[model samples]
Target chain A: MPQRIVSQRIVSLVAGLLFGVGLILSGMTDPAKVLAFLDVAGRWDPTLALVMASAIPVAAVGFALARRRGAPLLGGSLRIPTRRDIDARLIGGSLLFGVGWGLAGLCPGPALVTAAFGIAPALVFTVAMLAGMFTFNLLFEAGSRPRGVAKGSGTSC
Target chain B: MELAAFLPALAGGALIGLSAALLVLATGRVAGISGITGSLLGPPDDDTGWRLAFLTGLLLAPLAVVALTGRIPPVTIAAPTGLLALAGFLVGLGTRIGSGCTSGHGVCGIARLSPRSLVATGLFMASAAATVYVIRHVIGA
Candidate 1:
């Protein structure tokens, strides 16, 4: 109801729209293409690397601007992570994500978009992904801070 | 440089990064896809409206593009449906365990210069590269 909330919502919507469009345009939504890229032996598609390279500058500019600006338009201070250490959680998660990507050849963004096309496999992937998320919540519920605490506390926001 | 391939890749990456920047500027929230999707599982709340809207747009944009372009490429999967499902479950679990995904850690997390995100993103990229290698070379899957 607040103007800030409305503005945030609008921005979020726009961001998601653009992300989806990007996935489609990048040819990332195509599982076969992604698989081909992953397939280094047969025919390696290095397009993804180029995409990442191009994205880095855009992300860098965004980060620089947000850092300079300090607080966001919605009235809260930006919460960029300041640490750069490796841990078990990071390693474990990466391994799992890699395996999933290798098998399905569809990461989260494109997976959802492809699902919209009514592809049975994509639908299956989305369903499983949602279920996996739910399972994670159930298993690691304790790690998630209470919403009230997260909102009020300055840590881990 | 093939215009068709090069242009799309450049545009898409830029668009994704721009959207992420806009979301941060507007909402002060990291444009992490996992977090947005994960939020759906919890209890209903007014806060969910924006997340839902964002997700809807993600699904709809492709349809709009396809309608205009008159051709939507078919999706291909190397593994069977069951395996893909299992993999999805694993990703979900990993995200929960790790507290973020590539977008969260790799994009926003790295931007924030969070050590955790950096480590997470590094591990993710390395593991992904390794997995691809193994799958293609070793397993031939």
Candidate 2:
């Protein structure tokens, strides 16, 4: 069990490292690049679209392989989101997230990576993002489980 | 677009996919950045160490890049600080409430073919496009 825990941590560290590298190479960490991708009506840039298109299949294959094994190589059971019900929270929350993505091309991963450099914009944004997340917990999820870690939900950030 | 640009997108994206796959395959945990980071702000759990390990990796990526490539990529944020702050808050709150972010929903969830992720991705993509239209084209900001 102890060995399994160590392996999990190592895998996670490598995952994050690779993920950050991917973000930079894909331009997800670059606000200008992301904004250009989002500005569909403007002089749009389609490069980032290619990024997503290529990433999905790779991830899908990974999930399939893991599922086939009946368990992850490490220790934990799968904690992926399984809720089939599409509630108001999904719609409204997604829209809100989209608006925020539009406003600042920094999503959680890219934003955290950027903020690590001590850049003021990324820092401020990071702080506020944390605040917003904490506020939500206080409001709707105070006594509940970690909203993101609830049984069926996936993990990010 | 130039081949120079195209290759990076393809390569970078493939790397991301590989990263997600590796995490899921190794740990049985979906690699959603928002959820990983967001959960940490709350109470500690047995799941906490790996989460921190992952983030440390994220923060260390540039160094790894520099080691491998002999140079670090640049990050540019054009939005004003206040606007960025608001956007950050919304992302933080929205991702938690919604249960994922671009990586979680856009990449991993879609990969899983989760219905909720499909709808969330579509809705967010449309909303984001619309918001950009309003900001850039409509208001000309």
Candidate 3:
């Protein structure tokens, strides 16, 4: 039913554009800006907090709507996480991510946006991040997960 | 932050939420950047085409801004190249292990009111702040 309309590619494409532009306009693409936001002990900037806080109300509404719909509007397999157990992996890994984020003021999304801007340093960071992810898949999955199968446990991405 | 700064933060944030909301509403998929990017790696997925298309939009946003707004937002990375590389590597490994980043856990996960996401987001925020404290104030790096 959904195939006759616009494709998933178009939907995702628009989504990414919106996401990228939001990141840029919100100062998220600027590492220094992110650092200032995180540096609550030093020269603090609450811009990031406002961004997140504003984002939540809107996003929460969307999620609530989606949940009430019972299925995605586009007729694809819904993949929201249902896992509830919090474990050490989640805590430790989050700490590591936070450290990395605080260290360089870059995260996956903004890193990609900046890399796309043709910044050499950002490119290096993106490549290294990709390498880290690749290594993790190699060591952990050991080729067990076949291509196209969703990794739907704990969290994805 | 100045009062002027609030406009962009709130506007940009709403847009971000809108896109994520649309992605989930229309496609039943979360727009987790690390997950999207990581999915492209390792092997070809059935949804690779859509994923690639999504990323292309991300790449095109800068140019789009230039054409539409006549200017792009400035990006400043204060970290050295070596440091950036290390941070990127750690972020990659950590996100993969952690299963989400700021966007996933902080935004989408929290929107859905997941307990794990709340915990994860809290931890990441606390840890990130502490790290910044050590780097900027304590160690004064």
Candidate 4:
């Protein structure tokens, strides 16, 4: 392995650890806390908003610094999305995600953390989420594939 | 003020930001959990190794806290099993179609000042607030 890959792996591990720790410490992994934050008509908890308010500015600084350099420290280009168009897919999908988020207060990140506890409910949710992803992949492929595609030729997730 | 949640939330939010910053500096990758996890389901990318490593670190974090502090952070889930399943499914499909999630669109994308992310984030937050209102007030779900 090249030096860059090694550095990337180590840094990624550290970043993930920090993220998980933050989620736990911030009470983001708690469904009740998350739900309370979304409960706008009720006694709303502003902690989640505070979390975003604090995180975004700091992350903005990070992004600005990264953009200043020609490339990342590890010789890889940043993968920030360039598409500026906001279409139906984006709005529709976000609405779906929001409904789910409101229903269970478990988005992808905290859902995985919750699953780490080996609890049955979390486990069930995680499995179902994965299954949902798989189903989407199938539907996406079916919809996007060319009409004249060769047999047994498809991308596997 | 609810100092109990406020202080820790601010500190932890800072920590999360620091990690995201570090990832951008080191790997030029956005630390979007949904995008990362979503990619794992598709064809392999060169970044697969780092993704797996990051996931492993995420999974071990709670254990590390328990090891050092002798306490696992509390988690209270109120939704029933069927609802949980449906919600998980919707989240999975939605994140994929939307190409991001709270971490991606809300945090990382907004940090980059992306307009699409801004809209996506706003829409999701608004919709979530609405959904909560409907569930708790309208139908009383």
By TM-score, who's the top model here?
2
Compute the interface RMSD for each candidate structure. Answer: 2.7, 1.7, 1.4, 3.6
Candidate 4, residue B60: lDDT: 75
Tell me what fraction of the real C-alpha contacts between chains A and B each candidate also makes: 0.60, 0.79, 0.73, 0.69
lDDT of 4 by residue, B70-138 (tens): 987778888899999998998888877776788888888899888878888897788888988999999
Residues A1-157 of candidate 2 have per-residue lDDT tens digits of 5888988999999999999899888878788888889999889998998888989999999999999997888766876666888888888888999999899888888898888766779899899998988886677656666443566643441
TM-score for each model: 0.89, 0.95, 0.94, 0.92
C-alpha lDDT of candidate 4 relative to the true structure: 0.80
- DockQ scores for all the models shown? 0.57, 0.73, 0.75, 0.59
Candidate order by TM-score, decreasing, is 2, 3, 4, 1
Which should have the higher TM-score, number 3 or number 4?
3
Clashes of each: 6, 10, 1, 1
User: What C-alpha lDDT do the candidate models reach, one value each?
Assistant: 0.72, 0.85, 0.82, 0.80
On residues A68-136, what C-alpha lDDT tens digit does candidate 1 reach at each position? 888887775665544455666667866787677777777777878898988888888888988988886
Question: Candidate 1 chain B: worst 10 consecutive residues by lDDT?
Answer: B38-47
Worst 10 residues of 4 chain A by lDDT: A148-157
Off by over 4 Å in 3: A1-6, A146-150, A154-157
**On residues B1-141, what C-alpha lDDT tens digit does candidate 1 reach at each position?**
366767777888788878778877666666677767876786555557778878888988778788878988756766787888987887776665676776676666665566777776677666666777887788866
Worst-scoring 10-residue span by lDDT in model 4 chain B: B38-47
| Per-residue C-alpha lDDT of model 2 across residues B10-92, encoded as one tens digit per residue | 88899999999999989988888888888788777877899999999999987777788886576788889889989999989
- Chain A TM-score values for every predicted structure, listed in order: 0.89, 0.91, 0.90, 0.87
Give candidate 3's error at residue A68 in angstroms.
0.9
